[model samples]
Target: MSPCTFDGALPRALEQIRGAFAGIDFAEVRFIRDMNGRVHLVLPDSADQAEVVAARPHLADALGAYSPGSETGLVRLSDTFFGAALMDEPFLVQDINGTLIRLIERRVVGQDWALAPGTEAGASVAHPPRVSFFSLKGGVGRSTALFLWGRELAAQGKRVLLLDLDLEAPGLGAQLLPDDARPEFGVVDWLAEDLVGSPMAEAMLVERMLVARSPLADSGYLYVAPATGKRTAQHPAGFIAKLARAYLDNDRGGGEDFAVRVRRLLGTLERDLEPDLVLIDSRAGLHETAAAAILHLDADVLLFATDQPTVWEGYRYLLAQLAQMAHIHPAGDDDWRLRLKMVYARASEKQGALEGFRSRAYELWLDGLYDEQPAGGAEDAFSFAETDDAAPHYPLQILNDPRFEQFNPLEHLSTVGAAAIASSFGPFMAALDERVLGNEDLKAVDHAD
Candidate 1:
């Protein structure tokens, strides 16, 4: 098949190949898409190349491409071959139903997504307060909450940078930027251009990517590094291609991994804009971008959750993975646990709703975060209980408000007014100010109705 046809045709090909090779015991099968977008099927060394070539007709029919005498686009799965081609890794893995793939791409920085033993310990603690807003599932108003909180901070005369890391479903740019104010370049553009060794200097890239929001300018600076470039059909052409290329590692020059580049990107923003707080709108669910924000960036993570079974289950998996990391590198002076806080979004003030949600969150935190102590023993000074007011796992509630139901920062700012927004999110903002930002004197503004 042509490269264009192979763009999104992996599932059908996997099903057909599985059916064709049924009952044959193969060690491993890999699906690789090369730089030119051509798809290749990889098999273990034990498989006969001639057999694979003989099955070319079936493979071609499955792939919807007939490239004769091309060895059926088959390659041996080996370290050397894997290293030579600049291709995406772990495209699909074999499962009972043929091949299973995540709806969103997952990127791992190092081996098996685990950091080195001393990496976390050596992380810089002097950077500006970086806060990540995350949710296991969407529609919890994660990004909305971030926009409101960021505006509140800026209004309090604190410089803030709202970063849109949700590249797949970007909305912050539209939500915050006016038609004339949108940046010419965005995070994806910078990464893609850098990958291709563009001559644009770092200063120029920052100038074009970080655009200031005029609405918040009078209070304090609020700059946004949106996910995509200006909202025009002509601009950001080949967005999917740019996204695919952006995720690739810088193996040639700086040799920085994707996570490192992201960190550096934030660092550049912080340095250039000199924002007091950098609030990142992390991608929802378990994605590479989300992992980079949560695991690599030395940021205070505010995990947003609603009272739902699916949300809890997803959080359970995420926390369990984090718990393993905590176990591997037990809490030290600068541990990541110190930076985590839970936010219960869309919380109702009904008799038991808040408590019930808090209870479930506490249980998850206990299982996935808090280090267990010996039974009937004196607890460490820092040991956390479900009810501890000072514990990072404590749930900060954002009471339900109809005004925020259909939240749009630009529209709501004028309609609902900042006072109402602040009042609705009073407790959450207070907790964030006290715990994360270390701003005790600053309070949310109370505009008169």
Candidate 2:
């Protein structure tokens, strides 16, 4: 730790510290600012050989808009190893969520970083893909498809934020993100972290929590907001009720404008991490949080359905319910119904069962008896309709694979020789993202009405 030549315009007081540590040939500069807007220095990386590494001046400029840190600052983290944060003098600080930021004394030159050096601009938060892999009835593998979708998206250099809002039967957390790897923090902890918690700014939040590492890809991070907090408390009957509140109530750290909070969180994610998509795997049925959140939040909704009569009946019911709600709200220019995307899962091949289902439904619709007939008119709709059944009327595709045998949430991801359905539904997401907006940018089309 020897004094080195100073050149950058750091304040006069910091110049003395710079002079003392001039021997840091391997210096790495980082910045930390808290919710109250205080700036602090992160000191040098003791491991690297210091040279006058250049600072991120533009990023620095954006960061400097906040006031300098002070001993009596609004709020920030205290790192035992890094000592007390230096107010505006460029010390480290943490946020309420426990994210750590290391503000450099000044931007230095000639050092390598974890991410691309100049690419740090606009590299802020992550917006998890809001994906819904749902089915009208059981056996369609909606959750399983979601697992694959998340894995596939992550494989393409994308950060996937997956949520299991299927409260009554919460299982995805146990499936993909192992008990060994689940984050210490979860949706339930948001309240606890808000109250009796003091988390490390950088490590505890921005880096850890209910979040898990993607074993499918190299260090791909997966953050899941589980339906239940996985509390070991012995409550038997109150599960569903508590789960319902865990999702919709403001007490669980949800704001009055639940939609806006989700938007801001997504915006923060997109800015901070730049994730490709945020996928949500919701529960079945129309009255739960799974339906409410997606019906209100989805940029795209892919409703999965099997080739069974009962399933189709449920599918129709879901659509009707959604349509009913839409009528109540009335579609504005920002209407969400337009973002709906449907996918018929577990479709049987050979066109046998499917054909029978379609022909029967079509005749039922044409006869004006669809309303009167029980939704589940046939045993396996595909049977009576197919063998030579007509084409499907709406959005439907055959996922006729045996991998969907039972309740296996993870299937066919690594199957060497299986007849998996080939689908281009992945690209379907981009179009939907373009449609459902984080913010609407309405430019007038020049013309007369």
Candidate 3:
């Protein structure tokens, strides 16, 4: 027999098992795919024990080296923990050639990414509303938009907290915080220490060591939580060590996942700082941690794109993955999809470019996120026309500006003066204010020439 790989393991096992028990009932059987992508089968209580025993060799052969021992490939549901404990675990009805199999998958990463938020629309607590800036490709000006929006809100006398959830690339700290003004610890330290039940996490959270005030804001506040902090600056070598431990599961409290821990941390920061709003700079691309900011946090997620073929293709994959969650177990509110809006970053002035981008985006949303509007069905279906300005696919435009090419807010403050910033980000910020602050009367702060 040939050795089985991950892609072929499930189908081969299903064929072998079905062949071995041709007439047996399999209504309660489940195929479990563990974190490491190994396949195991659990038989229902009604299964024939003698048949299961006799088919062990076939199962072993189907699973190949994965079933090194007699007990590894198969188990009785009644005799194992999977029966009761995994009754509510999410699963997909996968087709192996022609046979349908209920596959329960458990993965250490991307679990939150594939699932939609379970809460109703606007049901979150009274804490400040979160807005995450995300992009599939880097340097699309996602972080710059976050900074500009935070500054704009702060200028309007609103306390804004900017979180750099881009742990791997760690740039927001140096962008805003000067060397002497850096905080003692930052988000990575808080997360890593919290996983091990360290008091330092609480200390850092409570004492403002995890956040710093940016001099860029003089009126209100632009609080920042960088991925790295003063300790990282002092000992650069240990930064990666802390980062490696940051994404681990939290063992201290009910075995919380990484997303839950991030939400808790955000709650702590909101309570401590009492910001008017929170702007999170999410990690660009589909990194595992990006799920926390994009899906789990009760945040309005802004997806950035630059009208490139690669950009649309990347979004196609991301949205198609989300489509699975919507079709499988849609939240009762149907508002989660609305929480995602498109941003045409570095948009061109030519109308052709704008129209082409919008058309492509609308097609993607229609295929992946929008509800199907059947004739004579619900008039309130969550579908929108291609030209609907209110649709999630209709992007808010940010004009291309050469001044922001290599923007450093601290060093190039003159390059992005009020007029320049308003010209580039006016429409985007206006829409953002309406979404976050409910200011419908607001318009673009300045018009681009």
Candidate 4:
């Protein structure tokens, strides 16, 4: 069968098989689809093999394949067959209705993000810096900050590519793209098409998906890879279904994990667009989807956090996990801490509140990221105090501005003006430009407390 036929056949076949074997007592029924679109049904040895064999004719018919023969067709459950299929690690598996059943631990490929003893930095300076704006808890103006930052960079004549990886709650597209400028496809569309091995060319993928926003049209370009595609002839509501499938480990057998694919996608954008900087709007909290942006992608991570106890508690858990991962698999350099910067959003101007928030942040970093001191007196290569200027734990504070309380990018930009936005977020942006972007001479207002 053709790829299209295979695409529609697998789920239908599984549903039919489930109905056909409704009376059979089986531990679990798994439907596996190989790279070449061939299908296989796996069940525990407890299942009645004779009954399964009897249902072969119906399965073949449902799958639109020739009767079980040497061609690309269903294979009977056997020890040898199972072993061979296991080696290939079929691209995807589903039950009666295309619900992916994850069978393997998702492995992250590429640069590691662990900050521990002996861990070294692996990021290359040649590529443009990819900065991820992340928050443990939502509603902290993470994406809003990203939009303003991108605008500032573009205003400085830097080409920017803004990627929205918040798949479940995508908003960057609507915020950035005007109705007429919205692209037919999006990042998710390209990802889904790539996962399914579509015949679309890479160049076509960039052309169809990357939407250029108006705000950065004058000085520099702002290209966006939104989460969902625009309504078009090619991309319809069915594309949403592809979004659900894109996050699965369906292509593990081919040695391409989801993280690796995400990296490749970003790389492709970099190659095609040649943007000076890439800003990624990552998913909030700790999730497999967030892992690609946080850990695998070689990005300077901007970890946004509030003064809430629960927020810091979440950071503690996340940092502890990273510290442990670092111990197991260290990076090439110890610059993991350097690549990370803390952003305190919705911050208070009161000295005590600011100091209290910074103190709590310092404690979390010390507990989860800083290297352990030697028992004897040994000169440490790097040491940080909460008040140290060069420390990574220093918080870039964005004081609470009622103007940004209800953020709508276009409305805020038009009403507030870039000058006021810059004034409001001055210190944070200045620190970012100096510390993170290596622009030491940029004159910024003293909005820092």
The root-mean-square deviation over C-alpha atoms between each candidate and the true structure, in angstroms, is: 9.6, 24.3, 5.1, 13.3
The top-ranked prediction according to lDDT is 3
Q: Against the true structure, candidate 3 has what lDDT? A: 0.81
lDDT of each: 0.67, 0.43, 0.81, 0.66
Sort by TM-score, best first. 3, 1, 4, 2
- Show model 1 residue runs off by greater than 4 Å: 1-112, 116-122, 201-203, 206-208, 214-218, 231-233, 252-254, 328-333, 378-383, 439-449
Indicate the TM-score of model 4.
Answer: 0.68
TM-score of each: 0.71, 0.49, 0.85, 0.68
lDDT of 1 by residue, 1-449 (tens): 44326444566556555675675443356655444444566666565666666665666555654222246365554533444242333222223344342211233433224442226432564578889998887778888888877877887877788888888788788788775677777777778877766765374454555455646445766778887756333555689888887777776554766667777778777776777788998888887557777877888888898888988899888776565456334445555677778888998889988778878888887777676667785534235767776666678889888888767766666788767776778878877888776645564433221
Give the CA lDDT, 0 to 100, for residue 382 in model 1: 37
Shift in Å, residue 33, candidate 1 = 22
lDDT ranking, best first = 3, 1, 4, 2
lDDT of 2 by residue, 1-449 (tens): 22211212133223333443464331243444343434444444352222222222322342343424232211222332444434323232212123223333232211111111112222223334465656555456677666665665455445667766565566666666555556554443442233332453223346545455545443454455554333423343655454444444244243322233334434543455445566766667654444434554434667665556676576565544343233222233334443454455655556465555455445433332122334768532222222221222233454555644564433434562222423423333333334333443322222221
* lDDT string, candidate 3, 159-269, tens digits: 789998899988899889898888998899898899898999899987789988999886667899988888988898888998888888877545767787888899888
TM-score of 1: 0.71
Question: For model 4, where is the 10-residue window of minimal lDDT?
Answer: 110-119
Please give, for residues 331-387, the per-residue lDDT of candidate 4 as tens digits: 334455567778889888786987888788888888877765667634543347789
With a 3 Å backbone cut-off (N, CA, C), the pairs that clash in candidate 4 are 91-250, 119-333, 120-331, 120-332, 120-333, 120-334, 121-333
